[model samples]
Target: MSVDREPGLRERKKERTRRAISDVAMRLFADRGFDNVTVAEVAEAAEVSLSTVFNYFPTKEDIFFDRQEDVEQEWGEVVRGRKPGESAVAALRRHYFEALERREPRSGIAEGLVTFHRMIEESPALRAREREIGERGVEALARTLAEEAGADPDDITPRVVANQVAGVYGALYNEGRRRLLAGQSVEEAYPFLLRAARRAFDLLENGVGDYCIRPG
Candidate 1:
């Protein structure tokens, strides 16, 4: 009989410490402001040393964007595990709607208070960091698409598809943020995002099909 090796106590403890530090940092940023919160204060509140906090998160911005890695992983999974008959655009559209149904915050349709949404929009650093994350996500998605299509990494088709898919998410995220800042509840924002996603993907599916069949 083979015994499955679970994570050791030390590893679990380290993960707990990491979460504690990140949670404290987010709470502080939400209460005061992202720009004003200091790493030392977060370390003290989380009962970890400053070095430990840095060990978990290399920089202050990392704590605020802890879930960025998760988003990239999900995007890769969608492309790599798409159904046999599904196009890349179809796979991404399905993933987005599934996230919406689950009320995932990364979908940008989850219930968050208006203040938090406004605070993110008002911070230039956060906005810039978010754009960087967006680019990373697009690149990851493109790599997965290239694998699925048996194309080179630098091929234009994968890049174009990734741009379209990422553009849909970007538009949805901004619309959700705009509506939340305008005092719309998550319930009110959900349908609008869903409709927008459908329209965006429809345009891509039609446009791509036409382009692929066009004569040289």
Candidate 2:
């Protein structure tokens, strides 16, 4: 039992150290913009050596957006873990609404999002990194869809569908973030967000054929 517990204990210690460094770094970044905060300052504030910080985070941006890897893979995991008879879009839509219902940070309905969004918006490096991260998420979802459909290597349908699904989801998330930044309380924005999410997903599910045709 002692031997079995040793590895688990070590892993927990490592995770705790990583979380501490991340928490300290985010505080500094929130207080002073991402670009203004140095990795050395983060290490000093976290009471860890610069080398230790680097051991966990390869770059300063890495420290600021520590959960990025999880974000990149999250969509793929959600689709992969969907229940029997559930389509990928249905699974993702369900997961997203559930997140919003909980007022979770990832759903962009939590407190402190204004500061976080402003920090990212103010930093060019962070904005570029965010775009890269979004692209990776789309790619990850596309790959999963392709695998699930058993598509031919030359088929582009999976990529096309992935972009549309991700696009709708991204638009809804951005709208929520924008509303939060514009000073709306989470409770005030909840109903509108829920309506917007339903309408967006409904468009995707039911298709948007000739909704805005010009009269001849």
Candidate 3:
């Protein structure tokens, strides 16, 4: 069957090749460990050349985190695209809940992700890579917040806000993963996740010793 999914045939072929390689790599990594598989093995198994693998994935970790850059961009956009007059904290809070409603894998609420999470847990290198990704997300959010406030490039407030937001996200994400991996279904998980997230964001909005006051 002649295909018309994307604009061009060449693009379709490229997508097929990328998916094929990714499927092979993930299967091998899941069968073996992430640290044990080399790019050459992945290429060979996928019937691609080593250079082709490097073309798509600069490192083996890149294969695991194929969407990391897109995710970082989304974090910045979440702050930048917040509704007019919305505080950064409010925008992030709304985004967090929306991700839950959509069952986003990044939110750690989606099913079928525990195996992938387990893979990361089993690899020291992947754990370090995940930390690096978190730091990058914080930096991107900080840059957007600084832009919004027209702050000096050296200002610490944006960085502080970014750290606070990132810390909240990291804690919530890990806790959610713990619950989900422990066999709680999405229906059983989100109520507690929402409650905990609300309290966490409340802490950010109204500092310690103060009640949360919704913005006018």
Candidate 4:
């Protein structure tokens, strides 16, 4: 019988190297602006070769948005891991509330003073990239919903419900950013987002029962 060995020191070192590169890149982007910072600078600051940096992060933007893939993965997990009788929307609603309670960074109510928020708002490229990420999230959620409902890929119900759910999150995210830009504290933003989220999900629970409400 072959025993699977745990990741060796070399593998651990590689992971640390990748994280260091990403950390250096994000720091530079936050301080000097994303577009202004070159890959060479990031490589030098990270103490790695330019090719090594690219090996970890294919694009400069990937450095700044390192958490993007995690977001997609978590969305699927929320849907797939819902309680036995829970609906997809219900699972997401619970997840959002839990994040809010913990003030998780993904909740958008994290310290309203995050510099990354300002960076993204200031960079059109990053903003456009964010929209693309949102689209991907919608597509992912749609696919998951279709599978859960055993519907065809082209079915309108899952796509429409996915869009509605994604829209709620997108709106809440932007509203948090707007409030922060307007100088509102996270404390100030919290209640507003909670209220808005409740209303949005309530609408989904009622208005689109056929699509969003779990069947008995």
Candidate 5:
């Protein structure tokens, strides 16, 4: 999953080529627009053949989401690898805060992320694909939770929990992105995001049964 530790000449070259291609593709996409460019153009601009591009990325969207699988596994891995006595919500909370502390790009709260965000918003295809990826993430988390809880195949609790957890995270992430795209710098938004994240995760961990009442 990590290429930083990779050794040998061939592996290093392939990594460089992949990075070059991805970088070129993003730059082109950001400059003109995602829909305005084509893979062939990107290949020509990057000086790699179309086949070479395909060898690294399967689709145009793959060019944008170069680490799709890694990103998907990230949340599930946090839950799956949670320490003893750590709830899934707590594990995810810890993972998210770690990203916020480092301002990791995956958190979508990092600086310059709005450029890519704007591109995705402009492209319906990318928007649909991102939504699909979100659903896949939810399913992956649900499966992991089910396995951890030793739930019966017919049980829907894990799946339900997954949806709720994913929804909470999606909301928190969108809120962070909103603040950033509103022209707030990372330094300004991150503190507020951390507070928002803590509150959202707290609701998940503590339950929402009494969150709101009619006050009758």
Candidate 6:
């Protein structure tokens, strides 16, 4: 909800330090698994004090999911910043297509995506952390939709819509990861992903809106 501003020198420096620490942590996690990598080990690897590492990352899971806060807010941001005449589903569909075209990491089709996802799949703690982040994203999206529609607190429509959208998005993400884990290169898997995404979003837009209605 806050407006963006240019980072100051100190802020930039701090960001650099944070990124360095995270990069170090990720490499350790990749090489030795998340649970095997200790916070003190990460501090030693990154040449930062243990306290400094804790200052930036409250937990080992936090280090692994360093950008989760930004990720949790993304669905709300997409809806809030949609074009004047665009529906929320349409806005999300467009955003997802663009991210796919760009091969963005958030699109689940970036470089090292296989390794990144493999790390998550192998780590129970990371998997649980991922689920927590996903639930937060759904909550944020529901809250944003309710606010935009001026719905009362008791209205469940926004929450239902949010869950629907989140399920679709998660399926799309996992499909991409599944292809990569099956040994398909990004280029090899992209066309399939595009088709799948289009079908999924189209279903969200036109197929499910009136499904299984009971006759009065």
Top candidate on lDDT is 6
- The candidate 1 region of ten consecutive residues with least summed lDDT is 207-216
Estimate the TM-score of every prediction. 0.89, 0.92, 0.87, 0.91, 0.88, 0.91
Residue-level lDDT of model 3, residues 9-81, one tens digit each, is 7888888888788889999999899999999999999999999999888999989987889877777788777
User: What would the C-alpha RMSD of candidate 4 be, to one decimal place?
Assistant: 2.3
lDDT, model 5: 0.82
The runs of at least 3 residues in candidate 1 whose Cα sits more than 4 Å from the true structure, single-residue gaps closed, are 1-7, 113-116, 209-216
lDDT of 4 by residue, 13-83 (tens): 88899889988888888889988999999999988899998898898888888888877667767888877
Q: Kindly list the per-residue Cα lDDT of model 6 for residues 86-173, writing each as its tens digit.
A: 7778778888999999988777787788989899989999999999999999999999988876778998988988898898889989
User: Each prediction's Cα lDDT score?
Assistant: 0.78, 0.85, 0.83, 0.81, 0.82, 0.87
Tens digits of per-residue lDDT for model 2, 17-113: 9999999999999988999989899999999999999999999888878999999999888878877667777778888999999988777778777
Model 6 / residue 95 / CA error / Å: 0.7
Best by TM-score: 2
Query: Rank by lDDT, descending?
Result: 6, 2, 3, 5, 4, 1
Candidate 3 Cα errors over 4 Å, as ranges: 1-12, 207-216
Cα lDDT, model 6, residue 75: 95
As a TM-score, model 2 comes out at 0.92
TM-score, cand. 6 vs. native: 0.91
Please write out the lDDT profile of model 1 over residues 17-134, one tens digit for every residue.
8888888888898888888888999999988899998998988888888888987667778767766667667777788888888877767767654656665777788888888888
- For model 3 the TM-score comes to 0.87
Candidate closer to the true structure by TM-score (higher is better), 1 or 4: 4
lDDT of 2 at 105: 74
Q: What lDDT score is found at residue 179 in candidate 2?
A: 90
Instruction: Count steric clashes of candidate 4.
Output: 0
